[model samples]
Structure formats: structure tokens, C-alpha cells
Target chain A: MARIYNFSAGPSMLPEPVLQQAQQEMLDWRGSGMSVMEMSHRGPHFMAIAEQMKNDLIELLAVPANYRVLFLQAGASAQFAMIPQNILNGKTKACYVNTGAWSTAAIKEAGKYCEVQVAASGESTAFTTIPAYADWRVDPAAAYLHYTSNETIHGVEFNDIPDAGDLPLVCDMSSNILSRRVDIGHYGLIYAGAQKNMGPSGVTVVIVRDDLVGLEAKNTPAVFSYAQQAKADSMLNTPATYNWYLLGLTLQWLKGEGGVVAIEQRNIRKANKLYQAIDDSSLYRNPVDPACRSRMNVPFVLADATLDKAFLEQAEQQGLSTLAGHRSVGGMRASIYNAMPEAGVEALIEFMAEFERTH
Target chain B: MARIYNFSAGPSMLPEPVLQQAQQEMLDWRGSGMSVMEMSHRGPHFMAIAEQMKNDLIELLAVPANYRVLFLQAGASAQFAMIPQNILNGKTKACYVNTGAWSTAAIKEAGKYCEVQVAASGESTAFTTIPAYADWRVDPAAAYLHYTSNETIHGVEFNDIPDAGDLPLVCDMSSNILSRRVDIGHYGLIYAGAQKNMGPSGVTVVIVRDDLVGLEAKNTPAVFSYAQQAKADSMLNTPATYNWYLLGLTLQWLKGEGGVVAIEQRNIRKANKLYQAIDDSSLYRNPVDPACRSRMNVPFVLADATLDKAFLEQAEQQGLSTLAGHRSVGGMRASIYNAMPEAGVEALIEFMAEFERTH
Candidate 1:
């Protein structure tokens, strides 16, 4: 069987070229006589690989000179706890926007370390729309303001960065990071798991401004301390060597496809086509607000719930894999990240149309 | 270039068969039309892979029914903190044995969470030998007893498990796990980073007894909480999926190579031959006590300090790579984990003899 377009919410599709490069180097990486997985993290061979990866990511994101990029483990989920641990900075409270599942999770974790002020919530609208920023009641004494840039499960995304006044703005960009260009200067910190837009799972990329690097709470694990990790260049301990290599390969591939700017254009085209098909049909309807629907993960439901099983079965047969939405929201979701090509989205559209016509 | 013998301390060599299998399935895994890296961790394909890998490890270790094996991220470095956080069980003090560099580091991290009581110290002997059990000061009031089974940097290993008596026994087996057989029933928890005897660097394996599962200190990150993560089957977050697959492949390869018993025999033979060669040579010497010298990492120094650079250069030219000792204790170190074949060890011994004859 040939490669199929994997629509998994995460650990999803990767570009063919990146996989090919990794496959080619599986036995010996660039004549070094060791696979990337086999290299010592501190040795010259792996050091060079690590340096190039960090520099490439900084360049691609146009990260500011005052910021540090760290390649970490445990994904964005770790950052939920790390955010308050590193930057609460003796403050007693933190403000969080409750957008969807990811946001709610971050808020719950933050509650463990500090008083959590739910500045605003989309739950009132069933998480289908972003709450109006004007209605948010952020506490002036809050240490930081946090929000999920793109909710992977609810399919909601913030179109613009929210102002945090004097507090540092933190964002979880796990699902839509490299797919679009953003000014890194806008946030105090940005973190994303590599599984989605970057590469595979294991590595989490954290971009933090200078001021937010230090000031970790007492008893914070060294691995989760942004200040300690940044000083060591994210090699404070043995890193995920092979995952870093794969991430570097993916970033290089993204550059060859013309960096984030070019990929954003492709992503918009793909998302628009799929959403257009959904809106144009009576059988299928997307519940998310038109303005804030996630371009990375597009979730929709069929008019008749009985067709969900048949729709998924036929999609799998056609090589359209993992189209089922999250169990919490039972329908279908097409996660077309940067690695997901326009052709894959078109394939989904065509299949949906044919299924609607038949049923 | 063909694969060379890699002797790095931790992120070391993997079996070639495992790499070959991973490469063969890089693009599409067993006709799934998707790479293993691209599969949803919750999907049927990945669930099957995860199950098989866990069962194989359990079978290879002959793990008792009362233990839970977790595939986690952040390596054993994170476990340094997690062990204290999860099992302090309201006790203020925990006993720790300081054998070498790894034990020292673990003690440092554990101190942040609990009152650390030094049970024994090999430091007085420059970490070259383990202290006698009768001389160890076991604290009856302590929550647990922590010891590093093998020290990669100091080239020291414990020949047998230390009795913790009433306290739960925790062992950091990062560098030598699966290279020897051990009774799982003896331990309350056994943790290891996967870079050495396992597979790669991203995943950390934690095998914990059922009795030690729940008790977590307040503010422990949910991902690091044994009770929470065990309930979620270690998928508390998006795990290092590809790393888990690689680990599984490595475990399968180990099973084919006759499991831990067979590998232990090979490891002992490899260590003995390497040690005999060093002892026979006038130019080289191993400082560790013969009774407790590691059967995994063999750290040695040349009689002539000036020959260090030349030794490394010439060794590299002979395709013997990463033989440099850890920076903290410089000379030369050969980490011959379970994946290293007898032929590779023979090649190293032959090279050393030739180098000694000339210089």
C-alpha cells in the first residue's frame, strides 16, 4: 500500500521528503557511521545537528534576539504546569482564557500552583466561538495571561494575539504553529508539541522572551525550568536526539517549500476549500464560528448521526484515515496541517460530496 | 560508511536489526498506508504496537503481575524528581546511597522534595567501589531507599541489590537495564532512560510495584504523578510515539537474541575481555575496583596523559567512535551496552593492542 494522507489530530502526517531523508539516514547519518538516534547528545556530531536545528527554527519563526528557543520533552502538556512554575514569579494569581478543552486543561493545572482567574470562557457558547476579548475580566495582579492559540479538539482558533497589559502573554500553539507566520515579539512565550505542525512526538519547542526565562518556583524540576534549560541550550539533560533530527528535517523541508509564509498560503487555501465544501452542502455542517474555525483542524457533523459509522468506514477504505472527530465531539475532523497537502484536502472534499450524493 | 562502534555514555548504539526494521517501515507501516510516526497514539494500529511492546518488555523482564510498566518522557533525569514526588508518602526523609555521579545527581534533585538521608557513600573511595551493606546506615524512618544500580560516568556498578528492609527500594538502572536479569519483586520502582540498554533517548521506562503507585506530594505535575499517569496508561499526554515504537522494536530484537539471560552472559564476557586487555597492557589501566567495575561502561586512562588526544584520534580513524570518557572524568570510556556485539568488542580490543604496541 502507498502512503496515505493521515488525518490524525496529532502524530499526524509528515512530508514525504522528510520521511525519505530520515529513512535514507537510518543506518548512518551523513557518513558519521551512526544513526541520529545513536549519537551522543553532547558529542560534536550531535551538537552540530542540534545547533543547526535551533538556528533554523529561530530563522523560520523570525524570533526576536531577546528570546530563547528550547527543544524539550513531554509536549505542550508539560508547559501547562511549567508556565506557572517558571513565571508566576511570586505572584498569587494567573489569568487564563477558557476557550476549549486545551484551555480548560491548562487552567486546571495552573489552579494547582496559583489562584486561577478565568478571564473569559467560550463554554457558554459550547466552545464553538471565541469569547469577546472586551468581556474578559483579567485581574490586574495576575502574573501572566495564557490561552490556547488553536484548540485541537473544539476546532477554535484566535485570529489575533490578545493584549495582556503589563502581564506577559503566553500561548499554546501546538496545533497551528508552523502552519502560519506570527510575530514572536507579541508573546512572552510560545510552546507547541512537535507532533502536530513541527515533526513527530517527544520534542516540544518553547520560545520564550528574556524576562520570562528565569524566576522558577522553588522545587521546580530542573528539566521543566525554562531558565535552566535555556542556559544549557535545552541540553541540560540527554535530549530526544532522534526526534530533534526529525524535527530539523521537517523544518528544512518547510523552508524548501518556502518557509512559514508560503505554507500559510497553502494552509489557508486547503482550509477554505474544505470549509467551503462543508458550508455548501446540506448534509454536512461545521458548528464552529466561521471567523474562528481552526485552519489546522476542521470538525464537522453529518445531518443524520446514523451515517457517522458508514462515513468513517468508507473514508478508511478510500485511504482517508483517522477522519473521526474526538470522542467528546462525535463527528468527523480533518486535520490538515502544514504536512497535509492541498491534494489531501481535495480528496476529502470529493469523498464527502460523493457520500452525500449517494446517501 | 558502515556502522561503527559507538561508545557514548548514554545516548549510545542500538542494534542494527531494530534500525533496519524501522527504516523498512519508515514510509508505510505493515500496509497501514502511514508511517508509525504518523499514526494516532489512540488509533488501533498504534494501540496494537504499544500493547505488543509493553507485553514484550514485561515478558522479557518476567515482571510480576503487581507491577505497572510505564513508557514516559524526559528520561531518567525527570525520574530523579518524580521518585521523590510520588513516593515520599508524607515522610519527611528518604535514604539515598551515593555511589557516583548519577547517584549524586539523583540525591541533589530528591533533596528539593524531601529530607535526604545519606545511607552510604562510595565518595570516600572516589566512587570506585560500593560500600558494604553492613556499613550502610539505613534510616528506619525514611520513606524509601534510593540507589543508582550503575553509574555511567564513574564506571561503577552494584553487583547486587541492597536490602531496604521496611522501606520501598528505588533504583536508577538507566545505563544497564535489560543487560542483566533481576527479580522484579525486589524493587518498589525501577526507572531507566531508554538511550542506553533500551533503544533511544526520548522514552523513559518506569516499572513500579502496585503498592508504590498513588501517594504524590501536592503540586506534582499530573504528567509526573504516578497515580494519574498509571490510570491513563502513560498516555496522559501525547507520548513520544515514535520513540515508543523504536523501544518496542529493540525489545523484540532482544527477545530474539535470547532475552536478558543470554544478554547478561554476553555482557559479562564482553566486560571481562575488555578488562583483561586493559590489565595486560602496560599503557592502559582501569581505576575501578575489580569486584564492582561496571560490565557496561568501562572507563580507563592511558599511562601517559599526553596520549589522550592521539588515542581518541587514532581510535576514530579505526572506526572506533565516541570513546572519549565523560568530560567530568576525562580519559577514555567504552559503553558496551546490550546492543554492542561481541565482534565490536573484539575490534576495540584488537585496536587497543595495536595502539599500545606502537605508542
Candidate 2:
């Protein structure tokens, strides 16, 4: 098989090893004579797989015992609605730090269930940098302070996790989850859609504080109820089983590759190489402040904007895919997620250098 | 790969051809060197697949242009909340015919958003039959009347579609979708989770009337808004691309096998054979009414209840799996879906007769 590098934002790239393992197990998973898709979610075989995934994740993230992990359908967008519905607790207000497109969406969804205050915002900077904590005004009695840890679209990140004082902190880490080490004890909730850095598009991993479990409003459907889903071990309704299985494969890969600490070093190296190239080059520049710039999504623009199309086309011919910036804010973005090998970054850097020399 | 029969009710059996095609295309989908799951939902490749799925479904169902198709996530269960959110249109009430588990769930979720009237119910018979249309007491002013066309758990089906008498009709055809022909014009909405007879669990197909597009409640999330999804051509968010691809393959298979008309006759034959054998046997009994018995799932109980355990264990050892009925109502269930060849059903019947004779 030919080596291919995919740079999609989500449903993006998976580890080649995971894909190979999946293909091998596609028809008969571990001698079960059934594809993981065909296994009964309730059967012992599937239950074991689900348990192993949850266990591996707990180990990978060092998830505290007081937190509940839920493998749910619908992506991080669903959690936008689910978070408030579960944690509103009759509180009329919630604090949100707007960092990028995803946090903006989270704030919008939170607004429906509670009064959301923009405690801090990176919007004024075109989402190129995280707002300083000194500028934030968090309410003492607010239910929780919501934030997006990594913004896939704008390529902005909070290098330092926010301090919410005593208020619970909810983070949407969809784009950069498991790429680095974090103190799981610090935040009240951490949710990441699996598409970008984890496994696939269908499942969202939600880790919530145990005390926050059963606070769903009267109208909450059983399917969306945190308490209900948690009690059911995220098998509340037949989960995206195949996706769960793939996640298990990815988690195993992460473990075999020396876990989060080892992976983070690789991620840092990859991001630093690309960012250094952009910072040192005259033809391209990344606008975000170096301190808060994302290590996952690197959004940069060409000095001569007219050359953008030609650059993208040339990049595509060389097999560099999905380097186009989000249409919401156009330029170019190269998402160097955990699944993206160091060699891919080296190749991208080589290509950029060659393109600049020619153009 | 070893051949096996999967008897799961939802996330159920897929066509062998579909699975084979998927396996063959796992590493390189159409020479693109990207699995369908790895493709960007927005890209040309995925857009083509999405459009083709819609076109094929329209062709299969003969759906009129006036009805818009939205491929959504979160399963049929999500539609439970979505229906009242979109269709209520300020109407105070919605009429729901309680057939079995799925309909009951829809009514429960709908109750949160609108006044839900039990227009008719099969609960009196433990959901063993579809409620007769003559017995219905629909609210003329209700926004829409909902029913489950086929109850997977109860093994009951509506042999005839109901007339809503000017009110819009909504059917949860999760278990019976694409098994037979239907007049799509009569429905305001037809939603089915694509796990049962369709493809996978993540993608839910909702065929809604064009007029029913723009009435989401002010609080409805953009992702769940039918009107919003329709405008985006079901690329509202990164959808279950692999699942959608599989659905297109199933639709292609249906078309190749002479479409729904041909499948329906075969289903009828399969159902008749299995039901007839149960009726003839002194040792077995299926409680559903003759007019309402499902062609998809046939739940039967042994007359000698003591042998039920032995029968299931022996059946499993022989590679006949998931014969145990739903926990809600337990005995034995043989789900003869479109993918279940007649030979499998015949083999099951032969095993049943042998077990009965030996006992």
C-alpha cells in the first residue's frame, strides 16, 4: 500500500497502524466471526471491548475517579446542548470564554439553557490568540465557566488552562485532546469529538465531574440524560459501536506509542518545526501570538494573497490535502494532529520551502 | 473470513454484498487512497456520495420533489425530540399511535415539547398487534399524527398505512424501512434510523415535506434544525460518512435486486413461511394478530416454556444467534430482515422442528 497523508480537519486522518489492524479485523474480530459492527452492544464480547476502551482512556488521560466518562453519539455539537441541560441546576447564568468558532457555538448553545456571559474573548483578534485571564470577569455564582481549549478553525489554543476559581470549568478539547498532558483534576468537564485527534466523527468523549451527573432538567430525554447515560456505561442506546472499537484501537496505539507524555513531545516537535518555518519565512506568516498559538491547527496566510490558489493547487499535486483555511476565514491551515506523523510535517515543511523557492 | 448470521434488531444485519464492497474499499475508496470514514464530509468525494445517496433513496421511494430528505445523526430517538420542535407550528397537540417500544419512546420525548394524545394503542394486548385504524381517535387540530409502521420488539406491523385526514403523518419506520413500497406523498415526515433494514445506526434518514422545513423552535440547535440541515444538503456537520457510503451501497443493491417491490414479495414469502411453521407447530406460538404480524421480526414463545432455554443455547451452538427475545418481553425472536436469506430462515425452522421433536 502506498503511503498517504490526509490533512482533513475532522473525520480527518487516523493512524495507519489502526487502519491496518481494523482491516485485518473487519470480518472476524478476534476470532468472534463477526465484524465489530455486527456484534451486539450488550453481548459480552462488545462489553469487553467497551470496558477496555474506557479503561484505556482512563489510563491515557489519568481521568480522576470522581469523573464520569461517556461515549456518546452526535459529536461536540451535541455536547453544546447537553452541557447546559445537565448542569444548569436552575442557575440563570454561565460564564463562557470565546476563543474561536467552536467556543462561539458552545456559547450559543449555552445561551439557550442559561444566561451566558462572555467572560473573555479572542474574537477581537480574529481568534488568533487567547484572551488573557487578567481581562476575564467570571461571576462567583455562575454555574460553570465554559471554554474551548483548542480551536480547529482559527488555530488558537489556551496553552495555560483557565482558572475558574471555584466555578466548574467546561472545556471543549475536540481538536487537541490527548495531544498533550493536562491535569484532569483541574477541570470539571472535558469533552472532545473523536473526529479530529481521537478516532472518528461519530463519537464524543465527555468526562464530567461526578457531582454534575444527575442535574438534567425535567424535559431531558433519557438518551441525552447524563445520569442515564453514565449509569448505562455509555451504552445508553446502542452506542456507535464500530466507532468505539476504532477508538479502542487508537487508544491501544497511543499506549503502545508510549502514552500522552511521549505523544505530546512528538506533537510539540511537529508544531514547532512548522511554526518555526512560517515565522522565519517572508512568504508566509501565522498571526497568533507564539504563547497561545495552537500546536494542532496551524493557520497561516501568504504575503502575496494572489498566490494562494496556486500554492494550494501545487500543494495538492504533491499530496498535501485539506491545507485550505476554513471559508469562515480564508488563507490556509495545516492540522498536524496526533495521528499525523512527524514525517508528514517534515514533508509539508519541505514542500513549503520548495514552493516558496519556485514562486 | 468465516460466514456468520447476525440477528441484532437494530444495528442489525447488513447485506453481504455491502459488507464485501466496504471491505474491498476499506484502504482505498475508489482509488482515492482514503477510506470513506477518513474523507472530509465537505469534499467533492463525500459530496458525490451524499448526493448519490439522496438520489438513490428518492428513486427507490419515488419521493416527490415536494418532500425534502435530510440525513441526520442521533438516531430515530433524536427525531422524538425533533418532531415536535419542527412540526408543532404552534399547534397545542400531536396525536401518537402507541404501537410498541419505538413509538412509546417518541411519544415520551414529544410530550416534553407538545401535548401528546394517545390516538390509539396496542398496549392493551402487550403491543402484540398494531392498533386498528377504526379504533383511532385522532385530534383533528393536532399538528401531526405519529405511528410506528413496524414495531421490532412486538413483532407487529401496520399492513396498511393510515389516512391522517388533512393532518400530516409521521412514521418511525426504523425496523421496516425499504422493506416494501409505500406512497411517500401521504407523509409529512418519514424518519428511520439506518440500523435495522437500512445501513448503520449513526445516520437517521428523515424525509420531510418541503413545507415543514422552517418551523424549528427558537431554541433548536442549528445542527438539529431540519430547515438548516436541508439548506446544507445534510452536510450540517461532519456526518457518519462511512455509514452513509454503506447506505448508498445498500440502495444500489436494492436497485439491482429489482427494488423494493421484489424485496417485499420475498419478505412476504419469508414471513409467511416462518409464521406458518409457528402456527402449525403444537410446541410454538406467536401472539401477534394475523393482520398485524411483522414480516421483519417474528417473536414466538414455546408452548413448553421449560425448553426455551435449551432451544436458545442449542440454536446458538449451531450458529443461529440472538434468538433470545428482547428483555422487555422475552421468549425467542427471529428477525428475518431483507439481508437474512431464505435459507437461513429455513435452516432456523428445521432446527426448531428438530428441537421440538427431540424434546
Candidate 3:
């Protein structure tokens, strides 16, 4: 296989060890004579895997005992709709902090279920900075205060977790989950699509405070109800078994690499290295506020407008793939999730420096 | 590795060739140096796979030029809600035939969006047989007539297609899809979960007539809107890529094995062999009516109730697994979808005969 470093936003890189383990077990998982995909969700083999996955996630994230962790299907976008359906409770109003594209989408989906209050926005700075806490106008009676911890598109992140006081604080941690430590008790719900720092795209991790169950509107579909899904152990319907297994392997990989705290240090170092390259060079620039630069996704722009395509093409040739930015926010984005090894980021920086010298 | 045959209802068995290919491609798919799971949905590598999957499904189903094919996440159960949201078209009544567990779920979901009318039912006979078309009470003004072609739980199938004339016909073909060829023009819509006869459980294949588009209720989430999904080529949201690839590979395998027509013949033979064993023995009986006996799922009961646990345990020892029946209907169910080679069925029959002799 050719040497390659994947930098795609998501459905991104996974730990090599996890992939290797999964490959070895593809046909016969743990001598069960069947792939994980071939086992029934209700079967003992799969039940064990499901239980281990839940247990590992709780340990990795330090999720509170009072919070129910759900292994859901649809991606973060699906949670965009689910959050409101489950939490709105006919409150008709919720506070939203728009950091970038994903939070905007969550807000839009939530709009269908409730009146959204824009608590704060960084749109004035082209979504490159987190809105200051002082500017946030949170409604005390709102159902919940929602935010995106890491904006994959804008490369902006919250330096300090927002305070919701007595209100529920919900965070879409899709891109940054497991890359660092978090206080589980601070938020009522934290959801992340598995593709980024977790595992794959099909399974989503939802950590919801136990008291939030049974809060869904009567009109909510059974599939969308947290209470119903939790009751069924995320198996009210068939789940993506292979994906779930792959995620479990990923959790095992995380544990082997000294868990989230250790991985978080590596993530911090990787982010610092890439940001330093951009900061030191006049050829490249990241627009995010230094205090709030995202450690997971780093979106940057070229000093020369014409260098964008050339930079991506040369990067691809050098084995750096998916360096192109999201079209909604054009230039470049390197999503250095937990799976992105330190070497890959260093190589990227080295390549960026060389490219700058040549250009 | 110990040789074992997986008899799961879904997230079920896959072609050995597909599994091998997937394992081989785990690190780099088509030289992209990324597993299909690791690629972005919008990237060239994944786009090609998505388009190819759609085209292969179209060709396999003989889908008409006017019909749209969509690859969606959320299993067949999700479509239960989507069907009504997209096709209801302000129509209050829709006709449904409750053949088994799947159909019952479909009817329940449809009830959420419309006034549902049961056109016919097999409940009177414990869901062992499909009701005759002449017995149907379909509403002429109903937006569509819906039915499940095969019930995974009851081992009942619709041997004959129903004619609805101008009234659109919809079938949840989850368990029996790709098991046989059918005229595409017969139904207005057909959707199947990938786990049974297709590949895995994460993705669903939806074939919608062109005319069915543009009629969705505004309240429907964009993810549920078939029109939106079709327009986006099923990339409106992140899809289950590995499952999609598996389905594509399974489709290729089916075609290589002479397509659904030849497979149907094999399926018929296999179903006959199992049914024949049940018929020849006073020791065992399949409660489903012979005419409606499903070629895919065969639910059978031993005349001696005490033999149930022994049957499952001994069968497992003999390389047969998941012979236990659904909890709702107490009996053994062997879901012998297209992927279950004739040898597997023959082995099952032989085991059943031997067990009967001993017990």
C-alpha cells in the first residue's frame, strides 16, 4: 500500500491498529465463525459487543452515571432534528450559538421544532472566532442552550465551555469528541457522529442525562424517541453492526494508547504544530482567534488566491489527501482528529513549509 | 477459524467473495489509500461507489427509466415513516395489507401520517398466509396500496403481485429483495433493507416512481423527503458507506451468479426441500400455508414442544445457528435468504430429519 495521510473532514482516518484488528476479524470475529455483521443484534455475541462498547465509551469520556449513553444510527445531522424533538418539550424556544456550518444546520433543524434564539454568532468574522460569552443573550426559560464545540468548517472552537446555569447545555461534539477530556455533568446531552474522532460514520454516540427521557413530544417517531431507543438498547431496529464493532475496536485502540487524556496531549501537540506552520509562514494563514482555534479541524486560507488548487494538488501528490476546504468555506481544512497520528501532521507541516519555499 | 454458518435474519450473511474483497480493501479502496468507510461521501472515490451502487440496483431490479433509486440510511423501519411523509400528498387514506410483523409496523408508521385502511390481512390465520386479492377492501381514492412482499417473522410471502391500476402500489421488500426478478412497472414504490438478501442492515434501497416525487409534506425532515434524497443522489447527509459498498459487491455477486432470475429458481428449490421435509414428517410443521410459504424465511414448529431448546442447541452443534424463532411468534425461523446457499438449506433439512428421528 502507498504511504498516505487522510485529512478528510470525516468518514476520516481510523487508528491503523483498529483497522488491522478489524481486518483480521472481518470473517470470524473472536472465533464466533461469523463476522460481527452476521450476528443478530439480539444474539449473545453481539449483546456482549454492544455492552462493551457502551462501557468503553463511558470510561473514555468519563460520562456520568446519571447519563444514558445511546448508540444511535443517523449522523449529527439527524441529531439536529432529534435534539429539538426530545428536548423542546413544547417550550417553543431554545438558545443556539452559531459557530459555523454544523451549528447552523443544527439551528435550522431545531427551527422545525421550536423557535430558535441566536444566543451568539461569529458570522461577523466569517466564522473564524467564537462569539464572546458576554455577547450571548441566553433565555433563562429556554428549553436548552445548544452549541457546537468544534466547528469543522470554520476551525473555531470554544475555549471555555458555555454556562447554561440551571438550563440544559447541549453540545454537538461530532468532530472533537474523544480528542480531549470533558466534564460530563456540565451538559445534559453531548452527541458526536462516529466518523471523526470516534470511529465510523454510521454509528452516533449520544450521552443524555437520565432525567431527559420521556420528554419527547407525542408526535415524535418511535425511532427518534430517546426513551424508546434506550429502552431497546439502540436495537429497536437493526443497527449498523459492523460499524458498531469497528467503533468498539477504536475504543480498544484508545485505551491501548493510554486513553483520552494521553490522546488529548497528542492532539494538542498536533494542533499546535500545524497552527505554528501557518502562523510562521506568510504563505498560509488560519483566521480563527488564537484563543479558540480548534484542535480537531484547522481551516486555513492561502495568501495567494491562485495557490489553493496548486497547494491541494501537490499535497495529494505528496500523499496528503482531502486537504481541500468545504465549498461553503473555501480554502483548506485539515481535520486532525484523534486518529490522525502526530507524524501525519508533522509531514503535512513539512510539506507546507517546502511548498511555501518553492512558491 | 472454525467453520460456521450464520443464519441471522439481517445484518445477516454476506457473500464470502464480498467479505474477502472488503477485508482486502480495508486499508485502501481502489488505490485511494482509504477504506470506503474512511472516504468522504462527496469525494470522487465514494461518489463513484455510490453511483455504481445506484446503477447496479436499478439494473438488478429492472427499475424503469422514470423511477428514481435512492440509497438511504435508517433501515426499512425508517421508510415506514418516510413513505407516508413523501407519498401521502394531503390524502387522508392509504390502503395497507397486514401480512406479518413488518407489515404491521409499516401500517403503524403510516397511521402517523394518514388515515390507514387495512386492505386485507392474514392475522385471522395467525399471519401464516397472505389474504387473497379478491378479499381486499382497497380504497379507490387511497393515495397508495402498501404491503410487505415477505414477512421475515411469519415466513409468509405474497406469491402474486397486486394490481392497483392508477393507484400507486408500494411494497416493503426488505426480506425478499433481490431474491427474484419482478416487473418494475408493477409498483409505484419499492424499498428494501440491505441486511436480508442485499448486504447489511445500515442502508436501504428505495425505488420510487418519478411521479411520486414533489408531493412530500412540508413538515417532513429533509432526510425523510424522498424527493430531496433522490435529488441529492442520497448524499444530502452522510451515508453508511461500508454498507453501501457491501451492497454493491453483493449485487455484483448476484449478477455473477446469473442474476435474480436464476437465484429465484435456487430459492424455490431450497424452500421446497425444507417444506417437503416438514410436510413428510408428522414430527414437524410449518404453520404458514403452503401457497404463501416464504422462499426466504421459513418458520417451523416441532410437534413436540419439548424439542425446541434441544433443536436449537443440537443444531448449533451441527453448524446451524439462529434457528430460534422470533419471540412474538414462538417457533424456529430459518431465514434462508438468497445468500444462504442451497447446501446450507440442505444441511438444515438433513439436521431436522435426524433430530426428528432421535427425538
Q: Which number leads on DockQ?
A: 1
Interface RMSD of structure candidate 1 (Å)? 0.7
Cα lDDT tens digits for candidate 3, A1-359: 57489999998998888888888888898878888888898899999998998899999989878988988876888888888889888798999999888888988888888899999998888887787788899999899999999988888877667888888999999888888888989999999989998787888889999988889987567788899999888887998888888899999999999999999899999999999999999999998889999999998999997999899999999889999999987899998999989999999999999999999
Off by over 4 Å in 3: none
- Give the lDDT of residue B32 in candidate 2: 77
Return the TM-score for each candidate structure.
0.99, 0.98, 0.98
Off by over 4 Å in 1: none
Docking class of 3: medium
Task: Record all residue pairs in model 1 with backbone atoms less than 3 Å apart, i.e. clashing.
Answer: none
Interface RMSD of each: 0.7, 1.9, 1.4
For residues B260-292, could you state the per-residue lDDT of candidate 1 as single tens digits? 999999999999999999999999999999999
- What is the Cα-based lDDT of residue A112 in candidate 1? 93
Query: Which sequence of candidate numbers ranks them by TM-score, best first?
Result: 1, 3, 2
Clashing pairs in 3: none
By TM-score, the better pick of 1 and 2 is 1
Which has the higher TM-score value, candidate number 1 or candidate number 3?
A: 1
lDDT of 1 at B64: 98
Which prediction has more favorable DockQ, 1 or 2? 1
Docking class of 1: high
Candidate 3, B96: how far from true, in Å? Answer: 1.2
